[model samples]
Target chain A: MTTGQRIDTVFTLFVRLLLAGIFAFAAYMKLRNPAAAQAFAESIQGFKLLDPLQHHHLTVLATFAVPWLEILCAAFLILGFWTRAASFAMLGAMGVFIWAISTVIERGMNLQCGCFGEFSFPCGDTIGMCHLVRNSILAAGCLYLVIRGGGRVSIDRLLISGKPKVERLGATPTPTPTPTPSATPTRPVSSRPASDDTPIALDPVRPTPLSSSPSGVDAAQPPKPRWD
Target chain B: MRFVGRVALILILATVAATVHSLYWPIYRDLPDRQARTQRAPVTDAAAQDGSPTPTGRSELPEHYISVARAYQFWEEGMPFVDARTAAERVVGTIDGAIHLETRNFIDGSATRLLEELDRAFPVIVFCGGGECDASENVAIRLSGWGFNEIYVMHEGYDAWKDAGYPTEAVGGG
Candidate 1:
């Protein structure tokens, strides 16, 4: 690989690592023991997302589900296993977090963010706009992963490396494209119809294809089935 | 189908893992109303008087939750109330004679001298900013850890106390 390609790989790896590390530590803090879990439950209660009396079952479910899901998805991120799916789950979680934070802010409630257990950084001690911004940024990263998969250094990439491409029934023939982490914009071929592709990158790291293709994405293939 | 299905699968895995862990793990395995049940106050004065932690064998103690009416009754009986809400919340008014010893006070070690002043054997009444607030419960837990024999949390909070027309004084003459 060229110097640029190697750097890109390392950068992709770094993004995955950040996602894994932050989420894992956050999950561990909230799940270290029963007291920690109880504290987290109280934090969830503080948000008053659901009336503790009216939505008792849902409140309880969120208390148990949030941290456990975080830990599980963080493990997936670390292993790069089902990378997009894991990221999609986290992205959904961040949406809930953002909504919860906004609700508390709207209610003018100063709440303790039990986000990283007792550790609150970058957003101060209370849940506020800063916390919302932080969650938004993390959500963006998750969206990127959902769109781009986990990149070349990921298990997602490794799994797809030598697999045969699954093109749509009516797509035109083209050369098999290399498995680059990003959409090879300048180096595209027949996978996507020529007029239907975006030649520019969306993120600093990579751009999501406007449409998703099955595994073993050869940039050269015709436009295949999309998420849409 | 594959992408969405995989995401659903991740969620399923998370839910299953949480169910298993919550059901099986001793910590999470405790009853749901554990906060009310788990009082860590010293079993007896022997260990407390010795200036040593004696958290062992606390099964006999009852839940620390007390209704607002009961709290008022305790106030009439001369039990000192502890305000566990933040300074801003307390500025409006507090249970007359209630001392401000919020959770942050304990965390920052500022509540130490005040804690020293209160008798460990006293059945202290703690309250917070009211509904959905756990500050009082948190302070009660800390007090329990400090060997305070009976620490009751008024979960309905200070608002309920005031709404009931109970005797309340300005926290700082406000």
Candidate 2:
């Protein structure tokens, strides 16, 4: 493999591993206290997303679901199975997280994020900018995968055999064109056509002018006053 | 993938599960619901300027008795000590000069006619057994209900008084 390709492969692997580790840790912390998880959800002020989950069971369910999704995505990415799909899922989760945090901050609710619970590194009421920065970096990585597709060592690549079929060489002869001006323009229409095949003309015809005869006497004007 | 990471993950999961279990386990287990049943009364500040009787009615004593050196001080001041324990328990130990009012009859005021005969202003130090006893507080509450204003629960109770080598007596059949 070329040096550039090798570097790209290494970078992709590193991103996948980093995402997996982060998600796994986050899931573990949340699974600990479902109440704290519920509180964290309530702290994200917009739309009252947690209102319906005010009950204990629903709250616990939400706590489980979020972390479960994170873990599943992380596992998929780590195993290099459906790498692009997993990365996209992670990206989506991160977007929701960012929105939730921003909403919480905007609404001015003081609460622990429960991201790490009591084991949180620097003690504070809210999850600080560090969490956002970390998630943003992870998000960028996921977006990269979304665009670039999975790199070497991915199961997706292995499962799908050789290189994608290229246009067949020397088969299906290129047609020699007989240029005809048959009223249909060759240029593709930039704007949507009014009808399926008909091309609209640029210029249109104007109406005829009146004749200047003395008998006609310019109906309304009356020969422009004698002073003229 | 490393051995250390695997071990760390296991340890973390175990610790988290244990903590969660501990916090919630009591809810399901038949543990005593102390917070619900037993109310801790606010301790009266010693230096408070008010000579008015500290509002003892608001407090809820956990057991029939409470350890009270203050009630002992009251006893030293020539106040009569009232033993509110059952006749059976009184046989074990009781304070000297303490009148016997068994747990049931004391709070019900079966001895009301006898008590009413005494001077209303005389200080009465009420107590039962150790700090776990609520009988003292119950008697005190009953006395307060019966128009006895100077009722004080000997928080330490008769047991502590006897333990301190201060005084003791056996009353009734015991």
Candidate 3:
């Protein structure tokens, strides 16, 4: 890989890990303490989004479900497994937050945002434009992930085709055939590590054929005499 | 959009998971019991020692709710009116003799001393902005939590009282 490509890979990994860690920690804070969930419910109640008097069931459901969803999506993002799906889920969650906060602001309601479930480290009891801006920024990060899969060095990449290490400087191998529906399922003998154990139906990356002769010599070269 | 579709799927899956977990383990098993019940009248013997507000006047409030007319009757008889509205809302106008006790004050323990000063036997008429406004209920809950036995929430609240041309007071002279 070129130096630029390597740097890009590292940056992508950093963003992915940072976002995933934030989500996972947020989820853990809510799930760890039962009182946190209650506090979270009360915070939700303050928003009056779901009236505790009328939509008690919905309020209860949201209080319990939101954190678990965060945990699920964060785990997927961290592993780079279904990264697109996880990022999309987080984006959706951020959208809900933005809407809720907007409603509060529009109505001039003083409410505490339960964005991080029960973890209210930065935001004490105030919910305002800052909370909206924070969630919008996080949503933007998720949008980036959605657009640019999991980048390089991800479980998706590993599950797809992993390029085998080159044994010699000049040696080149023939490209593997693309898996076809009509073709018989025969395991090709390969110097590259085979993904026989992976049950997922995904295509591996194929090597491009070189124009030079396969005999480790140019077709234009003349035979050379050597004393044996 | 694909993103919207994906979010829908996540919400569905999360809802299912949460529901199953709740059904099996029950999340709110530890929440304080909210069911309302009339407590056997407070023991007078302990009230003498702790300086607790002695239950006097009426034995106990017949019901948790009282109509505006009933509240007015209580008002005429000098019952304390607790305004559950925010300070900003209170600036406009309020029932005469209403004491401002916001939900925030209750949560922060600022209202504790004030509540302690009130007589527990006298029915405290709590009212807010009325019509779908839940402040009155929330404040009433806190009053009950603070050991106030005879609590009455005015169903019509301040707005209705003002509309009816009842005696009202404002922050600044009008």
**DockQ of candidate 2 against the true complex:** 0.02
Write model 2 residue lDDT over B1-174, tens digit each, in one string: 342453345334434544454345221000012122234332245413534344333334433233455566666777777786656566686776777764245323476775776554655768777544545554565454445545566677666777787866667434
* Each candidate's interface RMSD: 4.0, 15.7, 4.9
Model 1's TM-score against the true structure: 0.63
Better of 2 and 3 by lDDT: 3
- Model 1, A1-228: lDDT tens per residue? 346656766766677779888898888877776656656766777786667556755655666688878888888888888888899999999998998899899999877888887667777767889998999999998887777667666677656643222323334423333344454544333233311112211222222343244444454544443321
Per TM-score, what order, best first?
A: 1, 3, 2
Q: Once superposed on the true structure, which residue ranges of model 2 sit more than 4 Å away at CA?
A: A32-48, A52-58, A122-125, A162-228, B1-174
- The top-ranked prediction according to lDDT is 1
Worst 10 residues of 3 chain A by lDDT: A194-203
Interface RMSD of 3: 4.9
Q: Is the docking of candidate 1 incorrect, acceptable, medium or high quality?
A: acceptable
TM-score of each: 0.63, 0.39, 0.56
Estimate, for each residue in B1-174, the C-alpha lDDT of model 3 and write its tens digit.
764676677778888987875564333211121213334353356445854333333223324556787678778989899998766667788898788887566544588788878997766888987765556766775666567666667867787888877788874434
Instruction: Tell me the lDDT of model 3 at B130.
Output: 75
TM-score per model (chain B): 0.66, 0.57, 0.65
